[model samples]
Target: MKNRTILLTGGGTAGHVSLNQALIPELKNLGFNVEYIGSKDGIESGLIPDSFPDVPYHAIASGKLRRYFSVKNFTDPVRVGAGLVQALNVIRKTKPVAIFSKGGFVSVPVAMAGKLMSVPVIIHESDVTPGLANKIAMPFANHIFTVFKETLKHVPKEKSTCTGSVIRSELMDGSAAKGKEICNFNNDLPVLMVMGGSQGSAVINEAIRSNLTALLKQYNVIHLCGKGNADSSLMDLANYKQFEYVTHELPHLLHMTDFVVSRAGSNSIFEFLALKKPMLLIPLSKLKSRGDQILNARLFQQQGFAHVVEEEELTPERFLAEMQKLQMDEDLLVDAMTNAESPKTAYEMAKLVAAHTKN
Candidate 1:
């Protein structure tokens, strides 16, 4: 039997790589050879090879896809063009049955190469609106899976499916006791996990710290403080713990987390929803992003899965108020989350790739 091969592409932010991560083992379980095509130094470079040592990995020239003017813009396209040539060669060599993209700048060139090479391409969009990279790659996608039903309208209707989010099976395996053990928290207090994506958020770190004493009184705080963001002075706080990030232990952390405070990245929030953890989402300000996080936060709030606070509205007082609100409505949020559908989109996607492989 011929090896069924699928090439995965996504990077930049941890959000971009998350769906691809969810799909990796699922594809492997279906007997397809899993490999990744990513930028040489993006987050994918660290995550893919390290997390899935068995998966063959390739690095290619990659350029950032920017929406605004910058001096790097001119040079980046040259890199992007080079990436296309490199990607075309890689796809030709691998002869993958299908290409799956989770939408990042690195993916744009690869998707274009897949189109030129006649390999079927599948792209998953985690936002209500497509990012700059996916918009460019839309013409190449054989199918576009979306996390939100609302997002379908933004893409070619004939090619789009609302598959919800791709959540890894391991994300749901968290045990509260194991989580408590890992974080060294007392069971006497509820655990509150704060995540600000992979690199952490300076704004969130400040807000939490300014209110740390007040917050620690009510809950045991576990802060994923981003790289270089942890404060040594606060290390001695009895009810608080801080780490740069958690990976293998994330499931356990999630299992132990009774409530959450986080930025409203779609991938992260959806995972939190799957765990039925009530959340207070502080979306990245429009000044910081294209306001995707803001939209994501609002939608989750509307669905009763979380409470939303805009960055402009973020303050210690308001943060605590929202936390109080989240605590008061915990049962309702859990009920909403319980009834919510997890499309298990990665499996649906794996089936799609399998069908393409068979054909």
Candidate 2:
């Protein structure tokens, strides 16, 4: 186990990249050389190398698995297959001890290639419901790790471990508190952190756009306005901090904020729990992206971790009302954060996979 090489592949969005990022430094800390493989068009291209400047960076043409008709859908698999071949070559050259996957089409190839090369393969499902990529990679993977207890049904009992979803160590490892001066607000006012999960939900932005003034009256907001959505003309905001990408300050903002209005991406949901911040979670609808978010949000709501709402059900009025309700039920917030899963069990998955490689 001394200085073994490990290759990790996942990302088109930050949800996947963040999980990949969470595990890298820790793996390096354990004395493994780490390489990241991601889509050239995805968040990984920027986030991965930046976070681990010294680590090797590789890009593949990968994409989302769309539910409905799109011109781009047909060509995605072909591009992904090419990336898979490329990933296989990288693995052959590195001879990694394990391939860690976090559910991206980019990862599908990496996981498969690892299995084919007789290297260990471990896949971590960040959602309560597994993604299509995970579904495809499950059979080849030697072990599975997940954030939720429910994901076990989708994975073999022998191979699956509930380690929670691994958030970046910089994030959930009791390091969430930080410089209050950067936020520029008193400890009295509530801070609402709004996240759209890597792409910045247009619908969430619309809701906030319609009520920025109302939001400012009660709370200070730090909004992660995905790549192109930070339109200042939408509504003049006071006490609002906007970022196209805030790769570094996620945990600090989570700690500083009293509440959140967020998309219920599995990774995001787990972070809210880790921080014990009450959330008004809006799951993208059933018709959206294989309904993974909808499935994930329902599971979290069932566990009483967050109050779930659909984007269609969210309005400025609804958000304000939910805020009032959450403000009243302050006790529930603390109770919900005592969740069963954790994000640090990636080490457990690694050990299991490494064992399989021996066999």
Estimate the TM-score of every prediction: 0.97, 0.90
Tens digits of per-residue lDDT, candidate 1, 68-147, equal: 89999999999999999999988888889899898889999999999888899988899988888999999998988888
What clash pairs does model 1 have?
none
Candidate number of the best lDDT = 1
RMSD of each predicted structure: 1.4, 2.6
TM-score of 2: 0.90
Residue 95 in model 1: lDDT: 84
State model 2's lDDT: 0.76
Please, what are the lDDT tens digits per residue for candidate 2 over residues 1-359?
66578888888777877766766766766667888888887778888888889989988767667667899898888886887788888987887877888777778877777878888888878787788888888999888887778878877899788766555556654333462555555546778888887878888887876888888888888888788887766434457777766767676777787888888888777777777788878888876677788888887777777787788788789978887887776577668666445446545444444554432
Q: What is the lDDT of residue 140 in candidate 2?
A: 92
Q: List the residue pairs that clash in candidate 2.
A: 164-342, 165-343, 166-343
Provide the overall lDDT of each model, using Cα atoms, as 2-decimal numbers.
0.87, 0.76
Best by TM-score: 1
